[model samples]
Target: MKMAARTKARHESLGLSLEDVVQMYRVMLQTRMIGERMMQLNRMGKAMFVGVADGHEAAEVGSAWCIRKGVDWCVPYYRDVGVALVLGQTAKDQFLGVFAKATDPNSGGRQIVNQFSDVKAKMLSGSVHIATQFPHAVGLALAAKIRKQDHIVVTYGGEGATSPGDFHEAMNFAAVHELPVVFVIENNQYAISTPVKLQMAVANVADRAAAYGMPGVIADGTDVLDVYEKTKQACDRARGGDGPTLVEVKCYRYRPHSSDDDDSRYRSKDELQAWLQKDPIDKAAAYLLQQAVAASRLEDMRQEIAADIEAAITAAENDPDPDPATLTRYVYGEDAE
Candidate 1:
């Protein structure tokens, strides 16, 4: 009965026209494919680990789409591959980071993939410590304010990270200063073995925004339209000097937290089955097909993306690995020991 009930509520892609639907559909599909490819590499022993953004694509893409890459700053987390890629990362750079090859875009194979450093893109490097990105985001927004620039900073994290004090302090700081930042929590329901209910008291993460005196919104993370609308509204307000917004995106994770986790120990098969039925990429694809996107055009998009992924994998696999000789080259800047 639960399976039937959950399956029956498969997400309906929201948007007015077919073009907008197809654009979002492509992004969702690409994100899923990237996660899938990373998983394959992990299994092949080519990569040490993989962070799948399988279920959080909608929120990621929606957030990226609303901001200008060159002007805005992004404090991304480890699970932000899809969002970063969509915003401006190349396939080779992303794959190279996973492979730790010398050809990696950001680190040149030195730093981990998550420590994404790019100045022109204005992407603040990521940290392994959860919730750290929040404060960094606040700092960046404060800097932008001091510089009198129009750039806004957007940071992302999970509902589980919200349990930490950093999240609270960052939100409070952003609000107090009226910083141009958007705090987005991709509530994927499960943070490793713990579920959302165990992590917090409220049903929605955005509800806490009131304490900071800012607008808060809850969006359907499975539907790109919902995320896009909410993100644009927040960025617009922030740009207008209305302070920050807290967005709680309600989404599900089809896979475990990382490749190492086995969600079965904590979550029941029934729950997984329920969320699996509403896969955002598949639902969005179905919406595009329903909207009369030419079958040939859809096939072309698939072929193009597949070729792109395959090329990236192949290149990164053969690329030169990072040299051990210079392991301590950048340990303390150019002049430090």
Candidate 2:
């Protein structure tokens, strides 16, 4: 098999090896498959809820790839399961949270699904509220700067989150202090049922970064390499003490906001189909194929991922639920009692 000239050239220009992009594609695929399985579990009553990253996998994985798992910090939102996975939180780990099993590290079955956390990976625990993690990431970045450490911080949220005051506060503080933070907005066109048109008056969420005295970038979230390149640039700038960057990755949500939302009420079938055509997993696979990856090889990879997910599901299901007696363990201090 011969690599496509264009694909090879693009990767070379970005200073990325073929293997790096291929691994990124694998993580993206893993995220997509896991999200799909979670949705299926929800429908089957095996799980309570799922906030999938189907159409936004590239943005999640690619941006996550830019951060050093154990060095830089990741402040992910509830929908950023892909970022968590890429940061070393396995499918089993996520399933434990989804199933509210005792082994779940994020909350021990206390928090909602997809609120990923891993101290070793430097991934901060996420919340269900929009834009709350923005200030948290900014705070971490400030700490790193004060300590004169090389650590940087990466945070993610949706387009709708940009409307929140938390977002502006974080952006303003990071810019003013020149904190080492990168803000990634996965703009999927809708905030639950509210379209981008109604969410904000700005044409591009990235444009708001200029007002905060930082660079604003718009990247194609459906293209993994494009996202990787843009994110790498942002990470580099942040590490250089050039201040934060607001990156708006244009993406779409292929499913309803969650297992509970009825997307049909807001989105048209035609619009959904159009976005499906641009699915990030499909786009990444096509690029790999163009790079001389065999179709059979891709199929084999898919099978391996499927088996991994199945194993995770089994493990999570077999794991015991949190001990009811310990319900207030993390909630209250012993002195309070």
> Clash pairs of candidate 2?
none
Summarize candidate 2's per-residue lDDT along 112-196 as a digit string, tens digits.
9988787888988777888999999999999999999989999999999999999999999999999999999999999999999
Tell how far residue 334 is off in model 1, in angstroms: 2.8
Q: Specify the poorest-scoring 10-residue window by lDDT in model 1.
A: 6-15
In candidate 2, which residue ranges exceed 4 Å CA deviation? Answer: 1-8, 332-337
Q: Per the 3 Å backbone cut-off, how many clashing residue pairs does candidate 1 have?
A: 0
**Model 1 clashing residue pairs (backbone):** none
lDDT by candidate, in order shown? 0.81, 0.90
User: Which 10 successive residues of model 2 have the least lDDT summed?
Assistant: 3-12
Candidate 1 lDDT, 1-337, residue by residue in tens = 3555432221233323566567667777777888888888889898887778888888888777777879999887777776777677777777888999876767778776556777767888767788999999999999988999989988888888898899889989999999999988898988788888888888788888898888889988887777888887898888988889998888987777888888888989898778878777776767677666687887888888889999988988899987889677656668533
Q: Identify the leading candidate in terms of TM-score.
A: 2
